[model samples]
Target: LEKAGIEIDRKVLADIASADPTAFKAIADKARAALA
Candidate 1:
């Protein structure tokens, strides 16, 4: 996220993600796809 100028701690992000896996995975997949 820092690469995109967003500042979020990894663990904090993980905790948030764990709270809503379906939503997080969709967005996370898109973000990872961007790297590809």
Candidate 2:
């Protein structure tokens, strides 16, 4: 994400990645939107 210039809390992201894939996708979509 850093390479994309999006900064998120690592632990929170990890939790989302492991426990809440829906949220992880949401976050990734949001980040992609931000980049666009």
lDDT of each: 0.70, 0.83
* Candidate 2 clash figure, as a count: 0
lDDT of 2 by residue, 1-36 (tens): 665676788987998899989989988987887778
Q: Which stretches of model 2 miss by more than 4 angstroms?
A: 1-7
Per-residue lDDT of 32 in model 2: 81
| TM-score to native of every candidate shown | 0.50, 0.69
Residue 7's lDDT in candidate 1: 58
* Regions more than 4 Å wrong, model 1: 1-7
lDDT of 1 by residue, 1-31 (tens): 5554445688877886989888677767766
